[model samples]
Target: MAQHPTDANVYFVPARSKAPIFASVSMFVMMMGVASWLNDVSWGKVAFFTGMAMMIATLFYWFGEVIRESQGGHYNRQVDVSFRMGMVWFIFSEVMFFGAFFGALFYTRQYALPWLGGEGDGVMTNALLWDGYSAAWPSAGPGQVGGHFQTIPAWGLPLVNTLILLTSGVTLTIAHHALKAGQRRALLFWLGLTVVLGITFLFLQAEEYIHAYSELNLTLGSGIYGSTFFMLTGFHGAHVALGTIMLLVMWFRALKGHFTKDHHFGFEAAAWYWHFVDVVWLGLFLFVYVL
Candidate 1:
């Protein structure tokens, strides 16, 4: 079923239809909905809901085309390699994106927070808050805006979640090898287990967030402390959700017998995303939670 690239009518899946338009229009609707929700506008909510609906429809049709092509065998070895490379680079960009947030966390705590404490120029406010605030990082003083929030200890649940993610990465690697070795049953078992682990990590994360908000009183409005904390951890959690969905799709594809020893770019793509999310969590634990 694979056609030569040079074939003008190449069964190479020029089966193009409404996917592009659908994806674009669907995204537009989502944006409108988001804008409305933010601004508290009536049409904004309407637009936002409409947009979400459109986007869901669009993704369904768009991915259907990809599935169709995959099922029809337009993707061969070369195509699979390209898909792998593309996913690697995509995850790399995402790493850099999270790194920016981490960088901001470092800068705010080390530089901006001190200056604001008036060690040099921020002397007035520092004197006001600490009566002689020394302008150091981890400003766990009365001057600290979230002065009341008890910082979550890193040795407990955060560390446990870290181990879970690291273990998931290993399980995923085993599953990938199983697939390549043509052990379908082992592959299915390991992959399904990996997805369950991912969901468990997310559930633990939700519990952590709840603890922070209700008992610790660490809120988003808690000032700079609240802001940076949420910005770093929230985005990482979002990536985890996305990575889980990618794995779930691959799981379903495996159920349908969609891949082979040499042609499973789709499965590999999901694995790549999962690993990327795993690595980001390590960074989050070390920098955001622990340090």
Candidate 2:
């Protein structure tokens, strides 16, 4: 039920919610579960799944309340502006997050690897310390630290996932335009298509990871190459999963006629997030896979 305004001038002040606290606790549990699972704890997987379920439920209920508030016309132009600014900062922070991982990749490839191979510092460090060291991209460091592992070629699954993400960006933009043009049916259709693409991309990534682990023997323990490779791609995959869930929620809101042509920040925010994920994947594809 939408809230009817009694006074036009009063700004709506929402009561404090426990969503953030619940989210924090669930995240802590999830991390603990992950650490325990890595150490082969008996109940680790159970805890992880339980935490995941709790987090999902929390988000669903919290966002549903927010939707109700939105439909109730609680937010004003000022609130909308604040939402936009908040989203901008959130995306900016994500940029820095991925930037750190990329910076590590660059430093390792450009400086650390060369120095260890005795290319810089004008010292034959490889010969003096470790003989017959091969300095190559996708290398497992000196003496093949974690043994030999084949690198996944950039022309196959990775290229396919890249195309998929790019196409998703297009679909999402189309959906945004449809919303702005006041075409609800087209908006829902295109938004749902974007979610499907996101899911497909995740499925393909899972397949790729399985191939890397089983056929290529490229585990996280595979030294510098594998560590960086998995780190970048793994985090990106998690982002994609999150963005997909956001889109799904927006899709449901769309179906409920929760957005109008002039004010659909919820849809816009999800689109922004999805596009960010797409852009990050392009970076990973180029630096991690191609270069």
Candidate 3:
């Protein structure tokens, strides 16, 4: 039996479960499989897919259990607080993760390029290494590592995607407010719009990548610029995909009448993640594309 939401004194301590151990096993297998694949092992691809399937299955079961517990009223205010704190830390870790990549970009552009191009203390280095090599924003190094390449135009697909993401953020916020106000119809409509915008953004990004690779000669191998551009935008796309999935799930739950005006942390968590993704895209737009 589960307690009501008001019973905050009794913290629900779930029984010891095998989910954690299984999750660990899945991750270990997946990592090992990827490592092997990178090393060109014969069975690596099959092993990697197998491990991925196992991990996906494990997550599905684990999340289902948690959803059941939540809907059963096993979660009190304390549990809700714990969940909130957990989400906060998770987002914080993501911020750090992206920060490291951005830091690398900054270091390459500001320090490494200037130093290698004979600026200040690098005069001797430049004279000895490449003689007349000049520091530039999108250089492929003095050696021309990947030959000639062009950069994607910031005013084109990138701008469109930015607008789409910003609009999605607005729609998601509207959906959140609708959920909080007990307006199920508006909640579903706006959330569905957000999901559509997310998918559209992903489609445009794929088109951009295709254009970069086929026509523009911009690829991961192009130069430092290409690498950083792909890394930042690619990872952000993955996050957008994940956020879209979360929003879709929340939309389904909303259809099932699973949330209330006062008790809708699940919806709120998804909204938080979506907003974080939107903010990250804004940073990417300014730093990677426009600048």
Which predicted model would earn the best lDDT?
2
- Ranking of models by lDDT: 2, 3, 1
| Best TM-score among the predictions, by candidate number | 3
* Candidate 2, position 199, lDDT: 99
**Predicted structure 1: lDDT:** 0.80
Which stretches of candidate 1 lie above 4 Å from their native place? 1-13, 42-50, 120-147
| lDDT per residue as tens, model 1, 230-285 | 88888888888888888888888888887889888888888878888888888888
User: Rank order by TM-score, top first?
Assistant: 3, 2, 1
Structural similarity to truth (TM-score) of each candidate: 0.87, 0.93, 0.94
Q: What is the C-alpha local distance difference test score of candidate 3? A: 0.89
Task: Give the total clashing residue pairs for model 3.
Answer: 0
TM-score of candidate 2 versus the correct structure, residues matched by position: 0.93
State the C-alpha lDDT per candidate. 0.80, 0.90, 0.89
